[model samples]
Target: MSRLTRRRALRTLAVPALAAALALPLLAPPAQAQAGRNVRLLVGFPAGGGSDVIARLLAEKLKDELGGANVIVENKPGAGGQLAAQALKSAPADGSTFFVTHDHTVSILPLVVKTPGFDTAHDFVPVAGFATFANAWAVSGGTPAKSMAEYVAWVKNAGGGKGAVGIPAPASVPEFLVRLVAEKYKLDLVAAPYRGSAPMMADMLGNQIGAGLGSVPDFIDNHRHGKLRVVAVMGDKRQAQLPDVPTLAELGLPGFEDLPFYGVFAPAGTPRPVTDAFSAALAKVVALPDVKERLTAMGLSVGHVPGAQFGAKERAYSAAWAKVIKASGFVPQ
Candidate 1:
């Protein structure tokens, strides 16, 4: 008990306590405010596709919001989106890597493709919904069917077998819609799958496929060039760009009214704080006037739901499409 000895002991205890406090966060889950030094956004389609476009847009804003950290997009298109889903599964559960895609790859593909590498319910956590768009049912300009009714009748009377429908991203939302159309109208429509919308449009214009099903933007230019004819859209209401085109519900198919949406997700087990950070950043980006205007120009509607609600919406979409795909007798190829 000298004063110096007592002071030395106190200093020793104080140093250890300070070190422990600093190490606590390293052991605990990451905070929502901590953006990764680098981020990678995975797109389940090739470059130049709608999903890729959206991913890049968000990546740019995320980088700006996150102190200029590099945000990059990686496209892994194949297996009806199984490739990207699998890639996501292998990514660390940290917030750095995420997958951005539509309802098809997240919900529909699992139902069609047997044993896809990941499960939406168990393998991934919803981060945020970025935008929603409608699918357009269109045909090559040379086809005899010019309208929805005409297309239905043509498929019915073409020996119930000759004509084929091209679907971008088989086992996707558009493919399921094609199946529903065939069953609802009692037509024997054969389905042909393509890697992405661009390739399918090429085939449609070449008259290799009888008709095509994909996002409206995919064929918007083709329609403008007089190489494609939009028969109907799958939105609950008519699309602004194609106001004259009726929706499936308006055309007598009320059950096909769901608007397709695109969202971002991280692999399951990602920390909740990280998910919240991502969701919040996404909300900010979607709210930006320029971002909204740009996406709207591309035929996208800007909207976002919270992470938990987005997850529920994803599950609901999965169930709804499952019924449709089953009713259409679609088996995984």
Candidate 2:
């Protein structure tokens, strides 16, 4: 072949090679995008709250698990975790951002909110679930009621069948339980919703509210110190941290056998490898002896549930609560 012809052929091959090189980024997943970058771990509650505490605890170890990548906890507290969920939706799905939240924002919020602004199934992918927790009904120190039966009697007599209870957020499972308690005992009990458990707990500690329903972790320390009393808990079995607290079923409140879960999620379209890597790291973190002990002490039944199984659990939990919400005739806001 002539030298000029050979040169032309090489030029032609180079054009396709250059085109393929440019297209590689667009066609393939950003598998390495999560590496060597700061990870933002978002929590939908204020600092010092249960979700925030859990996020910080996991963040500490997850940073090391990710080969020394920094994991920063960013709190976006409002609308019962709606803001954080929406933040995840708007964020870049490059695996640098993740939301750590529980069943409320993902499962129950969509069910109760007429327009939650983001759909969990459409906007997010489950990364992992670390534990399941039970919700407990607690009374303030001012209340003489130390047991479920006594608490019911106290509420029945308050203002001649009128009372108010605090909940971490509006349209939550705690609110549903409040409604159930009202119907069972025939009291005019109202649910007063707060931004998060922290504020509700503040009110409880100040004796502003006679009773509140929240996670066992939310009330465990207070219950232990006698600052408040946890009279009843939701779940089939007693929580390990509050073994003396009777199950709501044992108190004849049998509907809330299902427990809530805590899990992490990444924005939809994040590379599966990125999410899987985080999930695997989270599993190791959860299995750490100190992490397991701390979580159990905080009333969580700690276990490492993979992403797919976590997602399935979320769906089943949502379905179970749908019936309760429907029966209660709750108008979505």
> Could you give candidate 1's per-residue lDDT for residues 213-326 as a string of tens digits?
889867776787788899899877898878888998997778877777889899989877678777877888899999998888777878988988888888888898888778
lDDT of each residue in 1-333, candidate 2, tens digit only? 999999999999999999898755444433233345699999999888899999999999987787777789999999999999999999998778999999999999999999998999989999999899999999999989999888878877765778889999999999999999888888899999999999999999999999999999899999899999999999999877787889989988898888899999999998777788888889999999999999888999999999999999999999999988998998887
- TM-scores of the models, in the given order? 0.85, 0.91
Candidate 1, residue 44: the lDDT equals 83
Model 2, runs deviating above 4 Å? 1-35
Whole-model Cα lDDT of every candidate shown, in order: 0.81, 0.90
**Top candidate, metric lDDT:** 2
Clashing pairs in 1: none
